[model samples]
Target: MIPEDHFGSDAVATNRMHSAGVALEELLVTAQKQDCLTVGIYESAKLLIADPDSVVLCVLAVDNEEDVALQIHFTLLQAFCCDNGITILRVFGVRRLQRLLRGEGANRNLEEHGDFHCMLVTNPQADHCRLQEVDTYCQESRRMDQWIPELSLQER
Candidate 1:
């Protein structure tokens, strides 16, 4: 069996870079639907540690860099989510996640610098749009053991 420590290897990082774009579109859509989302590694980790039950899903944007440190960071975050029984999804590149989280028409000047590498989507209020849909999707996806995006033929 492959060892957990090997996730930081160049081979694994290269492999992850190749397949990382598959689910980005879907992840962006789901992220926009959440009204209660926490951005940045610190905020996301805090929610995961303090209130795992309230976190609906975690979407980590991995940097597709040659740096092994970045890979290790993502791996550790994924492992923590798994241990906490929280469903986590991963996509390559923090740019996509940062733009999506900024939301459409949001004032760029008012926003914090988009340096965060991960985000945690928490349970939304009842009045939020598509809250039920996202929640159901997260639960079903986790139960099915499907973490990566399953793109259709046209999406490829």
Candidate 2:
């Protein structure tokens, strides 16, 4: 983490430094260790949605250390947060997740049929053009896990 004193409250910031894939992967692993099953990928979100009481925490792997696709992916997560059905966490890499999790090492609380379903996105570019609102975006994002994006937008 960068030193807090180095930043200005009024300034907008972007993470331009490209650390090896290790950092983001480490964070993912850490979050997972706390509630190991809190992560979801594939049809997992849909399955979680099926249960009225379940709270889905989504961690989207948008890169693999080559570079970070922060902005657009953040936009998508923002969209998910605005939606009632899912929660999104944008973590950078996938591999070191195990190590990071093991380092944090905590257990998750889940009922029967409860678990974290992590989808490691190795090829983010494959879905970029296909990811937008309407015919794209969540629709395509969920397809990786064999799911259809369930959008809930109705006139008030």
Candidate 3:
């Protein structure tokens, strides 16, 4: 799995999160306590948006100064932030990311930067290379025709 540092976020900050491989239900419970924003893709996010039990996106900015719940929520964010399936690039000041995605720039930049892992998968299973069969749930969901550019992680 690609680490969050590959995306260029504070790797140390993300690394500090303890993996709680407990259970989905337990995670959800922790999420609720932490007030995480649910980040969904395509239409799947609609269900999360409508549901009060959870938020709809992964990158949420809940204030953690008040208590540990929010901190726990952020911990979860940091956990998935480095997800190997996802390419969470660090966008400092440019909206050029849209262009990067629209073009095959992501793949090319990886080669140019010697950081190809930033855009393309390294040593993926033979099935992942096919693109069409790759599921959005896999994290690197760029293959599906349904993937909208807006849902893509863009930093302002």
Candidate 4:
């Protein structure tokens, strides 16, 4: 039988993770509304290279681990984000992210935007609460020795 303390700790961790996921989703939505979001691998990479200082956070969504090219891009992006002092968050479920960011009618833009794998949230016009939440979560994760901590955006 498991101890009650163990169950309490597990519950705390799960709640933290859920809050972090919600924070990420809200941050993305806010960025989109403010026109401070750069989506797609090429676009995000270009923005990161051209204006690294403007990028506040980098969110990577990977649905296919078997894709060699995608892995290479993620590796390079991780290096760049680290060098630039940008927070990087890895997430699962690209489709869920797309739906969250673009809504149900976003299929038309998919062809134009390529994929929702890589996204960069740039500096917004005003301070955002969700950004702070995500930043805190990242800081805590780092303190826990989790480099490039990942969160799932999929529905529970």
lDDT of 3 by residue, 52-75 (tens): 232222322221145475445444
**C-alpha lDDT score of every prediction, in listed order:** 0.57, 0.37, 0.28, 0.84
Ten contiguous residues with the weakest lDDT in model 1: 147-156
Error of 4 at 57 (Å): 0.3
lDDT of 1 by residue, 1-156 (tens): 888678667576444433334334444445445345667776677777788877766676655657687667767878887787766665555665555556575435317756456767666343334444444544555566776422111122
lDDT per residue for candidate 4 within 91-127, as digits (tens), equals 8878878777767433444436658999999985556
- Candidate 2's residue-wise lDDT over 76-149, tens digit each? 44465447555343443333343334343333222222222243222222322211222233434356572533
- What's the number of clashes in each of the models? 0, 5, 8, 0
Q: Return the TM-score for each candidate structure.
A: 0.56, 0.33, 0.20, 0.90
Order the numbered candidates by lDDT, best leading. 4, 1, 2, 3
Give Cα distance to truth, residue 6, candidate 3, Å.
30
Candidate 3 collision pairs: 2-84, 37-57, 38-55, 38-56, 38-57, 39-56, 39-57, 110-116
Tell me, what's the RMSD of every candidate? 9.3, 15.5, 17.4, 2.2
Error of 1 at 104 (Å): 3.8
Quick one: best lDDT, which candidate?
4
By lDDT, is 1 or 3 better? Answer: 1
Please give the lDDT score at residue 130 for candidate 2: 14
What residue runs in model 3 are displaced by over 4 Å at the alpha carbon? 1-57, 85-156
List clashing residue pairs in candidate 2.
Answer: 29-101, 41-117, 42-145, 131-137, 132-137
